[model samples]
Target chain A: MKVSRVASVFAAALAAGLIFLPLWWVFASSLRPGNSFVENLTPLSWRAFLPVGGSFANYEVLLDGDFARALLNSFLVAGVTVVLGLAVAVLAAYALAVLNFPGRGYVFVFVILVSMVPFDAIAIPLSGLFSTWRLSDSYAGLILPALANGFAIFVLRQFFLGVPQELLDAAEVDGLGRFGTLLRIVLPLSKPALIGAGLMLFLSQWQAYLWPLLIGTSPGKQLAPIALANLSNLYSVDLGQILAGSFVLSAVPMVLLLFFQRQYTESLSTSGMRG
Target chain B: MPTMSPRRWRDARLAVLLLAPAVLGMVAMRVVPAVSAFAESFNHLSLRTGVKEFVGFENYAYLLGSGEFHAVLGTTLLFNLVLNPVIVVLSTALALLLAQRLPAVGLWRSLIFVPAAVPGSVTALIWSTAMQPDGLLNALFAAIGLPKQPFLTSSGQALGSIGLMLAWGAIGYWMLFVVAGLKDIPQAVYEAALIDGAGWWRRLTAITLPLLRRPMAFVLVAGTVGSFLAFAPVQILTKGGPDGSTNLLMYDVYANAYQVGDLGVAQAEVVLLMILMAVVVAIQFRVLREERS
Candidate 1:
């Protein structure tokens, strides 16, 4: 028993260290001396993971460009996606889970199939469709497809299914319409589920790279991932700036995680194990 | 809970009204695009003129005959074959560890789970810098007197390196599923196993693994699809390069459509990917069913 207890502590610490070391390195390298590329990042030295003569030089340079715009774009896009996605998804989920109607089974299967069709598979035609209408670079093009979220509907449906029939019936008896019960009863009762669904959609949009890579190619249209990726291609982008940008990019989700820690983690596990 | 039993006509109208927006959006975005993409696979499209000429299976045949498609498909398969197992094992191990009454369980779980929140592109860039010739990893190699490795530049190492980077980002997220699975198992089963004089290994192999099949299956299938569709890591780190060593199928399809302007070829490649994903998911379902029975 004693041996097993000691083994568990050592193993847990090692796992935690491995997961965090890269994150620490990125923050450290960003603060390293010199505004240009980091030099002498030898692993044998503590300076590799912990910089010496640390400064704000990288952020000072990076903030002067489009990085802030990109961050705000990600925040705005993801925020809108969540609000719109949740509104659409919650209604659909309430209908699917609570309402009895013809062809409901078919709709359920159809929704699942839609989720299976990988977004990347439709990249060619979807972008082509937008290009034909001259909406290829617009925010609608980015936010629209993202809002058509089936997984959010599915997660919300699962939660809605667990709501008591009595409460919904009681609301209906008290002169609540369908939407009224949804708002006054179901939505309020499913707060954790709503938060989960919202976080899932928000995180995906915030982390998006491929769609922005394709559609949002112009300078003003660049999102965070696209802009961060461009740092690598630029002729004279400082390495520390790249690290600083990555940290900033990473820090948003971390902050969100802190705010919605339980909801975020629960939703992730729910998404994977959903039947 | 019972289905809502409002006035039948009113319920029907309300249901349609509620579902319309999502249904319409999905139709325009996913369903319509997928149908058109499928149609494009059967027709020859000129990128410049935007003209379509029907040529059933010619595009698919062309893609099947090309050595590049074969190589890209094989690379994708190899990545999944290696990556899925790595994710399964690591995630299961971490899940099992986290399920136990270990020290700092909440802190450890928080640390592991945080990386999945980082954008895949950002994770790719982070690893790309660390794996560069004079970066942290190679520095470690030098510190131990080992010769330096050309991580992203070497064709042999490029694909595996990309996989490792993705796995680093993926394993923790996948762990949550298996941890959820482990949490579902009844402690009574373990107690019964202990009463039967079972050792730790026996108890685990017999009770835990047997009961945790569903979540493990979930991890397996989801992780396979994820690895199959991976794009950002390959794009950022290698750009499907170092002699096309890391050119995954999705990247190949993307290059065909966007770079070469071969929309037909990209659509046909997408069809192939769809079939592969379907078959993999089917096999997983069958395996899970067998275990359940």
Candidate 2:
């Protein structure tokens, strides 16, 4: 028993160390002042140990500049996408899960089929349409395309199906119309699933790099990822600022994850396993 | 069972109201783009003259003829072939490790998953920084008495480095799914195996593997689709590399359409890629269904 305990402790420690090391390095490097890429490489130095001397100059520079605009743009894009996506997903999920209609299976299958198409494959054709619609380089261009994510629809439908049938009957018997039942009963019961779907949509949109990079070319219009990429080219490749910007960009999602740790883990795991 | 008149109209209206925005959005964003891409593929388009002329199957024929296209196709296939199995195996192993009665299990799980939450661009930036000549990785290697290697600069090492980074970042997320699958397997099954004098390896093989079939199918298909469609890492880290060695088909399509103004050729590639993905997914579905039966 003692031997097993020792082995388990050792394994846990090793795993913990591996995971935390990269994060520690990112934090430490980001905190370092100045563009001393070569100087900072040494493992142990007075520079590393210097505490209060480090400044938030890099972050200040980022926030006071186009970085701020990009961050706001990302929030706008991701936020709108989530709200709009959930509205559509919730209603569609309700229809598929509860309302009997012809060609229901076909709709579900169509959603699944679209999920299989990789974004890169269709980016060109999509961009062409965006150009024609004059939605290119616009926020609407980003949010509109992503609003139709099939994964959200499918997952929400599955969760809706799991809602107990008797509750629907009870609502109906209570003189509630079909819409009323869905709005009050089905929607409330599936809050966890809806939140899960919403969170997934937000994260996916937030992390979107390719499509945004392709469509949104104007400086102020670019999202966070595009902004970060642009930062490397704006001035000299200021590794310190780049690292700082990246750290800040990464911190948003991390903070959000901490708040919804349980939902985040459960939703991601369930989605993967189910799909 | 009451008069279906009001209910049916309401239902139809609700369905139309709910699905209209998404359907129209998808039609404009997804379906339109897809159709245009197919159409573009059959034409010869260039920016100089702003003229597009139909040349049916010529783009496909051109892609077939080019050595670079063949190389890109080969690289894409190799990436999927190697990376999919590695991700599945590694993620399963990690999930299995975590599912055991390990101490600080929550911390381990959180640590692994934190990277998943990190944006892909940030992850790519972190890895790119680490893979530099005087970067953290090389620094550690030198400390451990190993020769310093140009991990990302070397043509041979660049693709593999990107692949490893992607796998490292993604494995944690995939493992979580497998962990969920593992949890759904009742503890009694493992206990029964233990009572029968089965060793750890046998318990894993006989119990955990079989019970995990459904989740495994999901992971396999998803992983395959994801690998074929991978873009961010290649774009950020290697940009298809020193000699187009790391260029995957997705990047190629992007380049064709966006960079080269060859929309038709790009569209053709997209259609081919979609067909390929559909076939692979269908095969996985077949295999999983057959296995269950």
Candidate 3:
């Protein structure tokens, strides 16, 4: 039994190492001074995975460039998407889960089918349409399409369904309107689902590459992922700066996700049904 | 049903008001573009001349006849064929391993999950650097007295490397669902199996796995769709190749529409890709349903 315990710990450590060590290396290399990311790796020393003589030089250079603008743009886009998306999704989910209406079942089915439609496959034609409306190179173009995520709606509806019927009835008996019951009752109780769905919407827009690539082409509207990708593609590749930029881009969302780890994981568990 | 009274009318009106924004947005944004894409796929719109002509089945015929388009489909299938299974197995294994009561297991689980939280493009950039000839992976290989690999630079190994990056970014996220499923299993089932002298492998195959079918199916389907939509890493690392070897279908659609100025071909490819996805999803449902029965 003790031997088996040792083996399990060893296996867990190895798995964690495989996933976490590379990220640690990225962080360490980003801190290294003056393009030494390669030289440090040659002897496979601890220096390759540690910030021994670390400095903020790469970050200083990166922040001095246009990467800051890209980061701000990403936040702006993701922020607006989350706020507006939550409003739209919550209202629809409330109606679907609580209301007695004609064709409610059909509407729910429609939402399911639409949620299953992969956006990447349809992005080409969607971009063409957006171009015709002259929405290219704009934030509206970036935020509008993502506002009506069917999967977000689906998740919210599932959570709302789990909200007990008698609580809603009591709210109604106390003279709460439909919107009031939703805002005061359903919304308050569904915090985890809201945060989870919001995180989902936020991450979808935050890491969005193809949609932003096709729509927001101008320099002023550049996003972090696009900027990070372009940083590495330059004729003179700066490894330190690229690592620093990637570290920043990756670290921000990771912090947000970890902070809301419970909500995010639970949301994924619910959303897994849509798959 | 009875005719609408005032209260019923009010309720219906409220429902419509509540659902309007989301329903309208979904229809106008998602449903309209997708439905029109099918129609547009049958027409030719020349970007250079601004001339539009109805070209019934010509785009599909051309794409079907072309070797390059065939290669794109082949590469996409090949990538998904390897990616989905590998991710499912590895994630399940990780989940099973973590299901044990190891010390500081929660911390290790979060550490393993950190990569999934990183954005795909950022992970690709990190992996692109790490896969450089003299980078960390090769340095580790050399420590083990193995040869250095040309990961994203060589066409032969580029797709495999991208798959590795994706698996690294995704497995932890998927594993959590398996962990959740694992938690739902009754302790008595395992105890009963132990009393019957079932070994670990037997318990897993007979007890844990059959119980985990639902979550496992979810992982398989979600992993398939995620791998099918994989575009960022390919764009960041290879740009479809050292020799067009990594030119998967999604990238091909992007290139045809944006770079080559071929909207007709791009729309046709989109239609085909959707049909393929629908067919695969249907097959997965059928197989899973059969197994359940």
Most accurate candidate by lDDT: 3
* Residue pairs in collision within model 2: A125-B33, B40-B264, B41-B264
Model 1 clashing residue pairs (backbone): none
- Candidate 2, residue A235: lDDT: 58
lDDT of 2 by residue, A1-275 (tens): 57866777677567656865666677667776556643555563445324335677777777887888999999999999999898887777778888876566877777666666666567767877778889889988888878887778877888888889888899999988788998888888877777778888899789888889888889878998888877765556567777888888778888888777776666666556555
What tens-digit string does per-residue lDDT give for candidate 1 at B131-230? 8888878877788899999888999899988988888898888898888888888888888888889999998887888888888888899888888889
Mind giving the per-residue lDDT tens digits that candidate 3 earns over A124-203?
78888998989888999999989979888888999999999899999989999888898899999999999999999999
**For each candidate, C-alpha RMSD in Å?**
2.3, 2.5, 1.4
Looking at candidate 3, what TM-score does chain B attain?
0.97
Best by TM-score: 3
**lDDT by residue (tens digit), candidate 1, A196-270:** 899888887988888878888787888989988887778588778888999998998888887888876677666
lDDT of 3: 0.89
Q: Once model 3 is optimally superposed onto the true structure by TM-score, how far is the C-alpha of residue B114 displaced, in angstroms?
A: 1.2
Of 1 and 3, the candidate ahead on TM-score is: 3
Model 3 earns a TM-score of 0.97
Q: Residue A65: error of model 3 in Å?
A: 1.0
